[model samples]
Target: MTTIPVIDFQLHAVGKEGCVELDNLGSEMCQALEGIGFCYLKNHGISEEIINEAFRSSKDFFSQPVNEKEKFARSHNYNFGWVGLEVEKLNPERPVGDYKEAWNITLEDHSLEWPSEKVPNFKPSMQKLYEMCTDLSKRIFDVISVGLKLDVMNCEDQYVPATPIPGTIVVNIGDLMQRWTADKLKATKHRVLNPSNEQQRRQNRQSMAFFVHPDDKLMIECLDKSNKYEPISSIDYLNSRFKATY
Candidate 1:
């Protein structure tokens, strides 16, 4: 099977006059994405220090008492806080709860209330990681957009993918993006697994997902260049997708 492949941004270092790098990297990326919708991205530009420190903060937060973490329980359609283990079933089509947990973050707006005092230094560190990853996501998306012949600048500015590979952060396509692309891109189902070894299980597994989305009212549909999908509201799609979880 063509499973999730490891891809790097070396293509980016090549000169623009030659499409070789872009051509090769773009084809490889598109194939893996179309096959599994997930990829291991290397040289994504997010520093090792950023990911390490962020994970440290995440582990500390999850280590807090259950009650404290619950304070950020997903409210309304805004999935912006801690999700307790067994609280979510990624594929509700099945009968089991996902063995993983996560914290969903989004853009910081006036409406984006920050529950300060919950975890010290959490906001500052997280905000830094958020901005870095957000920028990286767009760079990777630029490759995908070009591979598909879609103008990267005209495509959604922020993107989401998944998996944490030590120095590399994972990126994946989402339901909204899939629907918008008429499944031209896949929203692959993925999850983090608890360490099976006794020793490994003792160590905590903490991951953070920066779920970036376009403005709420933006109309979403397959682009005019590819009119395979019907129009839908961006915010509505995000809310509806999250409702299926848990």
Candidate 2:
């Protein structure tokens, strides 16, 4: 397996570093996105306590009986809320759904419903983590945009492995981003695996993802640097992708 490149978030954080550091990190990000489409982010200022709390809450939420989870089933054709295993087939080439349970949250144009009554402090923890991750995402993009000379970068996002690697955030490019950039950045393919052993199966995987979807009506097009594809609405693009995957 190829090791994903890890990028230091502080290099681009305000006043934390200088242009040389930012440009270097940007170059690394550019290559990583174009090549692997996935990277590990660290030192982006999300506290250890917050990550732990989020994970704990997520595990607790997923641990609940299926009925409790179903209450927050996704609605409005939006992808936020609880998604059970065998529901999302990330890779059309694959014959099975991803072997993990997930909860998705989006900052704008919200449709997220939570089982807050059952999971104490769930809302607060998720909100804080979402804010921090979005902050990190935007700054990281700012660095990449500056380096690539794009006006701005989109904020779509996802989660990574569950291991307690200190200060680690897994960031991957989505299909919409791939479309927007005309494949300048690839949409990484990732999945949670079926447990191979009793010990592995005991650890039911749960993840929280912050997807930064652009407004539904906004036109998504290849950047000016590369007009390889025509413009399409973000919603239409997402619908086509999800319809095929689901």
Candidate 3:
């Protein structure tokens, strides 16, 4: 079995004073993020009920008939709406599509917006979850800035306006983090999965993903440590990865 590490952020939140030790908590987080691109964050301050609600709503949405879910597909923008089972191929080279279904939403300026009108109910639950995740994301970013010895608000501009939609788990790719960390940190890759088989599909299983992108025109580059880290073009990386897997 493959296991991903969960770094408890609550420890840092409550132990912020003690975390200044520099070598202990800071290094630990850096290492974990750089290696896995994803970590389970506990003590993140998002309520359990909110998380549960998002998941429950997602399941309900996916439970709908294929024709119903298709009404919400945003194949054009790749921003918001529903994605059917195996509709999104993450790895082309792998030649295997996942058996899953998902819905997406974005947050901007503390407001939520769905790309398509088909999923009307997406907004309410998405907004609730977005608020929680955005808040937690800000707190985590602050700690990361402090850990990197950068201004506490160094990464603030990146999150402002909070994107159009927000939530408990914000699915951001590795490209932005690579720029922010000068290639030292990675944006993790994750995909939604239909955990149950065909029979369960009738019952409906849905996953929600909230992906954050840098402003369209913004260019990300290496920071002060650019020389130390090898440069990888975000566009090329994404294209290559998608080609190989999807």
Report lDDT (CA) for all predictions: 0.68, 0.72, 0.54
Q: What would the per-residue lDDT of candidate 2 be over residues 43-158, giving only the tens digit for each residue?
A: 77777898889888877888899888989876656667877878877877778986667776765424355777889878788887887777776787777786564433332355
Candidate 3 structure quality by residue, lDDT tens digits, 59-80 = 6666668887776675553445
TM-scores, each model vs. reference: 0.77, 0.81, 0.63
Write candidate 1's Cα lDDT for 1-246 as tens digits. Answer: 244578887555222234444666777787766766777777766677877787777777777788888887766556666777778877666688777667777664336555467667676778888887677666667687767634232223233444446655566788787767667667766645556799999886555666667789999978644767668899788677667775
Lowest summed lDDT window (length 10), candidate 1: 149-158
Residue 119's lDDT within candidate 1 is 68
Residue 119, candidate 1: Cα error in Å is: 3.2
Candidate 1 residue pairs that clash: 161-171, 161-172, 162-171, 162-172
Off by over 4 Å in 1: 10-23, 109-118, 149-164, 224-228
Best model number under lDDT: 2
Poorly placed runs, candidate 2 (over 4 Å): 14-21, 108-113, 149-164
- Evaluation by lDDT, superior candidate among 1 and 3: 1
